[model samples]
Target: MIGERWINLAVPLALLAVPLYALMADEPFTITLATRATILALAAVGLNIALGIGGLVSLGHAVFFGLGGYAMGILAFHAQNYSPLEIGPLTFAGTKSMPVIWLVAVIVSAMAALLIGALSLRTSGVYFIMITLAFGQMFYYFAISWSAYGGEDGLSIYVRNGFPGLNTLVPIQFFAVCFVVLCLALALNAMLRASPFGLALNAARQVPQRVETVGLNPMRLKLMAFVISGAITGLAGALFADLNRFVSPSMFSWQLSGELIILIVIGGVGRLMGPVVGACLFVALEHWLGGLTDFWHVWLGVVLLGIVLFARGGVVGLLTGKAGPHV
Candidate 1:
């Protein structure tokens, strides 16, 4: 218990410490990297709610990620062009407000998740996995063919969206914004994990039969988890688009979805702070090993293989002596 508690607090603080030191040392690039990791960690947190807790392995989460990106893209694109978006008969004006963009992203993504989950949850195991993957690919192709929003080339935001009081143009200020959101998401995850619904979800994941015996609808619980998961991931997607000032079909790619899952596995599946640890490690490798070799992914694969075979608990599990519950 002591070790787990230490690992939980230590991982996030260490992450916080690095960026602080980087800021003090005037290494803006490192701060950017840290911010990327924080955003990715936020996305993985969403997945953890469903994958880690609900036992739903969705390879199509990129659908929500891309949806969030497009939400930002479409809104900011119209705003930048000074045109109102016309949908059938209703004319919607675009605004550069970050809060409005985030709200739209969350709502749209949640709706998408609900629609997808309603159908996908009908199947289990390999079927569920394939169905999710299929849905993701469907969206990927749709984005590719939709030339109105840059099509294969992708969309770009001319400027960063507006925040209440901060100048988001500053790298550190943007980092602060993302960091606060990450912390809030972490708090939400902690709250959900400690709630009755969380217990029921975990039980449904572990033993659906028993959950059903208790009159709890496992499908409903999973669907709710999926919706919340999508909303959070969508929010991360909006941040990611803002981070790059661009959105592309690549956001909906299988590779990004796989990386999100890999983040969860490498950090510690189902463990709080697992995604943070995973994202940091991933970004570190991308920054360091990427510069050393063109085939850095091969090395990453080897390391992941070792973890899968040897340290199933990932970094947090290895350090804290707690194995991942799902695997």
Candidate 2:
């Protein structure tokens, strides 16, 4: 069997190569599909950092994801209309720049995570999950009723946001931007996993008492991890909205959060390449299975059951014959 390290390298390489091939062959749809997978994987990666590492099973990550999407939508919307966004005593203008949008997305998502994690981290086991879910649902309903930015109707980006030195309107160029961001995020994940902070957080997850005994605040570590996770997921949400050129309340739905967890489970929890592999399989299955029948989710459900019962290590584990951090 191939080693996990090699498989990990190969998976990302294949992801890039296929998109590059699509661009060369003028297969814009294929490129778009790859881009979708990349962005979804990025979001899942964020969830993995908290769930896989810190044992934080948050069903409300959609809050941050939606926040990020809305950040982009609202900014782009205002910019397109040449209007200012006013809140209370503050007045702000919008821009179509991708960097600006991403910064806002990250900051907003991180701040929300801080607030949510502070409250949610006080609970353990299922309580934490419920709190997160409640927050997510709250945001979903709020987005639907807000009505300022199209409310339940959602917001659309008439034009793709601008990226420095690139024509984002070009499918291939936009895909490249997303791909590079995913790579950078993956690199950060790898580094974090190996860092002292990551190890401490993992240790806290397994034995909070021991971590506390050693003078580290387990809750603080977990909160920090949650915040970072939320920020990354938020960044992915921004990219996803850009890819579709739209943002809606659905982005905050509980279903989206569930799918992120499913992706982590399918790819291999705690594994570095888990989200990448899971996202690819998800997109491929949806494409193939949807064409065959309307109940593709039923098949998806069956696969998830099998993984939970038989292949706890996920696709990477099955292929490598071992479960390691390399996943």
Candidate 3:
């Protein structure tokens, strides 16, 4: 409990300290790195809901991430081109508003999750994993074939999307936006985990039969969790695309899905700060080790292997011992 309390306090302080130092040093790149960590952490937080609480191992979560990215790219592309988007008989003007884009991303991703979960939830074990992967691949190929946005070339935003009064082009300002969202998501995760629904969902994951005997529908619970998870991931995807000012089919790749899972595992499954720690480590490795060697992922693999074999509770567990639920 001591260790957990320290960690719960330390992670946010560390996150705050980075930006302060970067701002004082006039190093915008550091702020950008921190923003990336926050965004990736946000994505992992979404996945944590499904995997940690719901015990749903989805290898296709990237589909939602990519959907969010494309949502931003598509809207911004049309806005920049000064053209309206048309679908069927309806005509819509493109928007560069971040809030609008985020809403679209969440709604689209949630709808996709509902449809996918409705079918994929029918199976269990490896079958569910494969089905999710297949769906992800389908979206990936569709993105590649969809030439209107960029096809295999990818879409590039001419400018950062608008945010009411903030100059998102400023690295620190953008970082603050992302950081605030991460905190809110973490808060929501805490609320959800402590709610009755969360308890039932966790129980369903561990013992579906027991949950069923309690007159709860495990499938419905899982589906709701999956949809919420997708929506959050989709929102992260929108922020990510905005951060990079680019969107590509690669966001839908299975490797990305694997990386999101890795983030949670390396940080600590079911811990609120797990994704935050994992994202920080991942970004640091990608920056430092990546500069030294092209095979940086090989080093990441080594670290992951060590964590899996020795530190199953991840960095948090390593620091806190087997403590209570990480909040």
Model 2: per-residue lDDT, tens digit, 180-275? 899898889889989999999999889999999999999999999999999999999999999999999999999999999998898888888889
Ranked candidates (lDDT, high to low): 3, 2, 1
What TM-score does candidate 3 reach?
0.97
How far out, in Å, is residue 125 in model 3?
Answer: 1.4
Candidate 3 lDDT over 1-327, as tens digits, reads 446767878897899799889999999999999999999999999998998789899999999999999999999999999999999999999999999999999999999999999999999999999999999999999999999989998999989998999999999999989999999888888888999999999898889999999899999999999999999999999999999999999999999999998988899988888899999999999999999999999999999999888888888888887833432
What TM-score does model 1 achieve against the real structure? 0.98
TM-score of each: 0.98, 0.97, 0.97
lDDT assessment of candidate 2: 0.92
The whole-model lDDT of each prediction reads 0.92, 0.92, 0.92
Worst 10 residues of 1 by lDDT: 318-327
Pairs in steric clash, model 1: none
Instruction: Give residue 16's lDDT in candidate 2 (0 to 100).
Output: 92
